[model samples]
Target: MAYQCDLGNNQTVYLDNSGSQTIVTTASGSPGQQQQSSNSFETGAWTAPPEMYRTPGGVTLKIQAQGGDRWIQIQGQSSNLSDASSIPLQEVSQVPGSSQQPMQPMQPMQPMQPMQPMQPMQPMQPMKMGNMEMNNNPMEMRMGNMEMRMGSSPQNTGSQRRFCSQCGSPVQPSDRFCGNCGHKLS
Candidate 1:
């Protein structure tokens, strides 16, 4: 058997005991904007009086047996004690053929498929910078108009070289001043 009560502001609460478990459902909002939440308890859980039930959405229900009759009081987060007592809870039975169907048990989840292995990365190719090409060979390097060979040093075809005392830069032997820093060379 199911008993329903209407709360103000388009909200209705239903207590259903037709199945093995007892379910308390709260439905609110208008036709297209209706929102519902249900909380289930063991069938004999409500046999004792002054039982408190709290929904997942924070709605509190106080059920008590008074004068051989059951009474339910709903208290939402925003509702004050005075407002909760003002709303009368009347029990209404479900129509003969319009009772709600019991909820079905959830099915077991399927196992996930195995993932494919990743492909190996390809080897890196030679890189080219502005007018310069760099390869895996470390003995050779080429830039703009210059080429350097790592294995051998170039032979100097000029006379003995002189260095600037102030900047330590190599200067021409015949130069009177350092070409790099303009320092006078003896």
Candidate 2:
């Protein structure tokens, strides 16, 4: 025997519309004015870096607002943001134990892939010493007694010191060595 259905049967399916809210805004904060964490991104100074990733339409991020500190966890098997501050790279389905997530935007699945380790920046050039030939800058070069003059008078680094080349008694600036006795006193 076949059962007969009533023609007046009315069904009103209730669909949950939760994705309408995407942008989360905290109370208008006074930026760095409010005192909380010593180094909490400077409040208003807290900005996403250049290399940041964004979640997809169906995926959602969970944020826990602690006492001024926001603790976040990457939850969502298939949805993974590589850089939420710099480069936005969407992780592929290679995440481990990534099962079919719910198509609801309001419900975000737990992240399957672990956070990627941060890489160090590379140096521009190799570290190596150059020549020792001092330049005109007296600040870099140091003499035994004679201190190079800057813009005005030539001041001696040490007082009661002979010239670079002492001859017999006092070596003159013009004479490289002493006329009577040649002596290197530089």
For 87-131, candidate 1 gives per-residue lDDT tens digits of 344556662224455568899999999989989655456678889
Candidate 2 residue-wise lDDT, 1-186, digit = tens? 001111111211111111221122112125454221111122222122111223452222322222232322222343545433322333233222222454656677777998899996553432223433233433333344343334445554545334443333655555556656666545
Residue 33 in model 2: shift from native, Å? Answer: 44
**TM-score computed on alpha carbons, candidate 1:** 0.38
lDDT, residue 144, candidate 2: 41
Global lDDT of model 2: 0.31
Query: What is residue 29's positional error in candidate 2, in angstroms?
Result: 46
Segments of candidate 1 deviating more than 4 angstroms: 18-20, 30-32, 43-72, 76-116, 127-186
